[model samples]
Target: MSAADGSASAADGSVNALTSALWERRPQTSVRIVDAHAHVGPYSLFFIPDAGSDGMVRVMDRCGVSHAVISSHLAIQLDAAAGNAATAEVVGRAPDRFTGYLTVNPWQDPARELGMWGSDHRFGGIKLHPDLHDYPLTGGRYAPVWEFAQRTGCPVLTHTYDGSPYNDLPMVDEVAARYPDVAILAGHAGATPNGFDAAIEVARRRPGVVLEVCGSFNSGSDIARMVREVGADRVVYGSDFPFIDLRMSLGRVIFSGLTEEDRAAVLGGTMTRLLQWRSGRE
Candidate 1:
């Protein structure tokens, strides 16, 4: 597929020739896009050729992804202080290219920075991996963290799936309902595309919870149903990258069975609105 072309008028001048070239490599189905979920793991951790900062931008440029939210899996080993600092350091350089979620390991650190960092605007919210880091969201250790998030007005991202031991999906429900003010994004659509009905139901019942769609779109209707239940705005897009092909996943939605308006929201508008809520428009 050749890149899609848009002619620039004499007044504005043409866009980079490479921009159109990149678009053609994208799936037959294309949409102007912003990726809401993506991770920037260290080289040794995820073992991408050079998954460091610049590699991220390069992939974005090729895939026609305008922006991404980056997190690190190193949080599994490093304490939240170091993991979050690393995340912020990467985001700091490419403010235009990246937004980040502050990762927390409650076993090692309480993640006080989840909210406090908002003063500096370094992180968009807090990220937690229950099975990977072995912290139980339903346990008492997480109460204060949820309280702090409520006080500071940041969200929490939680990992869920059938293989994982921690059953935090129910716990996520409890917290989001208890702390109605604090927002929570169910990372990876509860980790099972087909198993997502319950999670979407939770988001439907609770306004603060959002279902983050990533790596789950094996079928086009998966995205269409997400929009139907969550109403587009409450749903967001992500690639979980260096793990999934950002371009392929975005193309899945762009070519999805959804209506054009709904597809547009999944591609970028909903995510753009979420960022706008945090930093006041991009």
Candidate 2:
């Protein structure tokens, strides 16, 4: 079938159309998709057979992901500078298919790290893994990142979960209030059943904060509930690719029983808006 015909079918709000497209590995051209959260490089903790950029882009093609924002596993776990460099390389190679998040290690000299790559157009935002780094989200060390984000009008994507001393929804809410200019993507949206409500409440209160849907715990129904609670504009889709299966994550959003408009926004519209400022800098 022609691309136009496919677009018509996908836009008809037929779940069967979407299901067939997914199962057949056909690109759904009708939907503009940008994966808000993703990763590259191998992780010591997990075995990822295809963790490099080439593998990532191949899957993105097969699944119809037009673009993906990535941070190298190295940046999040071992060496921030090296990891950021690796992420930059991937984005540089495929400027259209990818953009990168500059991973900042608060334990290290954050200011120095930001200074090195903050101006690079390949990097669209900053990524913080407070859970992995074991730093409290509200700690003073992350000040540089907030300040940089505010100045550049770039969004900050941070790892968040339930009941951790660091980077929970409440803690993210506190940071959002203090750095109101910085758009915050609450990664994982407080992963797990218990944290979902907390994530919704925080997004409801913080205009600058948006809930990113990803994680093993969230089901299609859970995604539908989040949209009902916070509104579709407040949620964005993320696939922790290389860590989790991207196809499964994308499938959840596609089949979540959301209306066509809501599903479109969650899949890409919201994230596209969130990244506009950074893209404008290019």
Candidate 3:
């Protein structure tokens, strides 16, 4: 049986079970990985219990991943408050190695509750899984969450793509258009069944909106296309870790044929600046 956090699995049921082409490449990205889209440990990689918090830190160290942002899948499935609190606790053990993203309920008293969560130091920003949360990003009820983030100078990370508009893109784009400074991160980088075009469009149209390197990968040509269409600064590295391998995912970025500067930005520099901004808030 697989434990949620990716601990002690049998050779048959490894983390690589559902991995992709990059997983097969086992490409050596070599650069220090900054997993922007990973879920923290202790919540199992897939939201099962007993994933163990230490698993995150240990695996990160093993893979040369310098840092990661942990979001609670629990909040996505169950209690938002508990999810946020649990995610915070995981990051607390190794603050230097992990960044916490507070998972909030899009359907909850988003305005009042989100405003109230501003002081949680563990949270660098907000994470929204519109598809999983069952809320519309463009819906008026969600505006308060974006507005508050803009006011507080924090970014919001949301799942966005070609499909799942109600859960992902249109609303993300709408909210992003509303608050340019909020730094909305378009999760998945539109990386799935042919979403690159839309991901590219968002990068072109939205100045502060960036594509996160998560449950997504690009063909060599696709990677080149991404850079040509959106420019490299709009790109950021992320690993949907525990769910994927740091080495493999980082390899996708490192090998994606972008300029050295662009590679630096995507590898970790761009996010490094974002983290510095977050530090001032603390």
Candidate 4:
């Protein structure tokens, strides 16, 4: 794919030129195409052996993704502080291209971890995985995270899936209602196209709730619907990289049939503003 035309010349996963041009033109509109959700390290669950920050950067360069907000497997799967430190180290190496979301488990000294990680400029937000942590979103133990977000005006991206007893949108909505000042990003927005509407409804009911679209499979039409129902500002793009292909994830946004301005907001503008809630940290 060359910039002269937007055609995919081959299926080698290379970005076509027209696609490149579209992303390249984003800065003129004062928005960067930022991936709001992503992860690094060896994921033991899915058996992904290894994918680090360097590999992530290579994919971003090819796909015209200006930056990515990332968490680490250590944080999500193993230990929060270790994963956060690993992520911070990676971001420290390429501060211009990467930012971090420090992962924290509710049961693990939540307040101390939140304070320790949140104070670092390299980390712009927080990431939570209730499924991995085996906790409910509204559980009392998780109160510190919500309180921290509310007080600091930081964004929290939590793993959410609709139709599940755990990690569903309704649970996220309950937390959002309690902390109106905190911005909550619903991870994957339901985990598939079918869950989009439920996630959209959550965002509709709570203005502070935002949808992070980053599942293994999502449809372009679903993305358009999200923009329409929740408005583009409430929807953000995230490629669950290494776990999923980044190029394919970028394609969803490019072909979602969104207006340029709305696309810009979904791609990066909204996240930029959300991260900025911490006094322009990212």
| Root-mean-square deviation (CA) per prediction | 6.3, 3.9, 10.2, 6.0
Candidate 4: regions farther than 4 A off: 1-31, 280-282
Candidate 4: residue 234 lDDT (0-100): 93
TM-score for each model: 0.81, 0.93, 0.81, 0.87
Error of 2 at 125 (Å): 0.9
The best candidate in terms of TM-score: 2
Cα error, candidate 1, residue 217 (Å): 6.6
lDDT of each: 0.68, 0.90, 0.68, 0.82
Q: Per-residue lDDT tens digits of candidate 4, residues 32-55? A: 789899888888766764597888
- Residue pairs with backbone atoms closer than 3 Å in model 1 (clashes): 3-24
Q: Which stretches of candidate 1 lie over 4 Å from their true place?
A: 1-23, 26-32, 43-46, 280-282
**Which pairs clash in the backbone of model 3?**
4-44, 4-45, 5-44, 5-51, 138-171
Clashing pairs in model 2, backbone N/Cα/C closer than 3 A: none
Stretches off by above 4 angstroms in model 2 are 1-17
Expressed as tens digits, the lDDT of each residue in 1-282 for candidate 1 is 223332223212222222344455642224557677777766344457656778878878766777787776565456667767778888898888888887767686464655545555657766777777676667677776687678666667777664455744676777777888877888777767545876787788889887777765355577778788888877777777756767667656655656556766777887776655566522
lDDT accuracy of residue 228 in candidate 1: 88
Each prediction's total of clashing residue pairs, residues at least 3 apart in sequence or on different chains, is: 1, 0, 5, 3
The predicted structure with the larger lDDT, 1 or 2, is: 2
lDDT (Cα, tens digit) per residue for candidate 3, span 108-207: 6666557666677777778887777677778777777777777777777787756784655556667777787878888877767467777777778888
> What local lDDT does model 4 show for residue 132?
87
